[model samples]
Target: MMAPNNHFATLGLSIGADENQIKKAYRTLAKKWHPDKNHEAGAKEKFQEIAASYEYLSSKDRREMLERELRKPAAPAPPKAPQSTPQT
Candidate 1:
């Protein structure tokens, strides 16, 4: 199966979007796609996806944690010592 898009894409926002921007986008989309509010065939499903994305991105700590994890440097592998050849 194909993988789903990231939370940012689901909300139509960039990964670096601020909390305010995220909230604004989510509110706008949620209002537009809400099942009761829209009554469209796929509106309910779309709203659920949006809600899940918003819930995940809404947490400042989680966002920061993901950012830090992405930004952290990877450790280098240790060098191997030279091997000496012995007479057979």
Candidate 2:
């Protein structure tokens, strides 16, 4: 089979993204590349490719697996302290 579209690579998602991530990524990209909004030559085509990827990854079984993966709790972020102001 041919290599997947570049947009999928850029989004860091497989042909196997979850429905939620697919929808989220699609909306994010569509907003960025909508024809009237983007001047790039292939903006529309890029948007369509994102949509297609979302469709492929949003199937019932795949979506469930994705959801399970998403549900795994993320590691807690590192704690931060307020920066002290330097004396003038």
Q: What C-alpha lDDT values do all the predictions have?
A: 0.82, 0.66
Model 2 agreement with the true structure over 1-88: per-residue lDDT tens digits: 3333433444556645555766787788879988889989999887777667566565777555655555566667789988999999
lDDT for each residue of candidate 1 in 1-88, tens digit (9 for 90 to 100): 3333468878887666889999999999999999889987999999999999889888988776655654556566689999999979
Clashing pairs in 2: none
For candidate 1, list the clashing residue pairs, or say none. Answer: none
Q: Which candidate leads the pack in lDDT?
A: 1
> What RMSD does each model have against the real structure?
7.4, 9.9
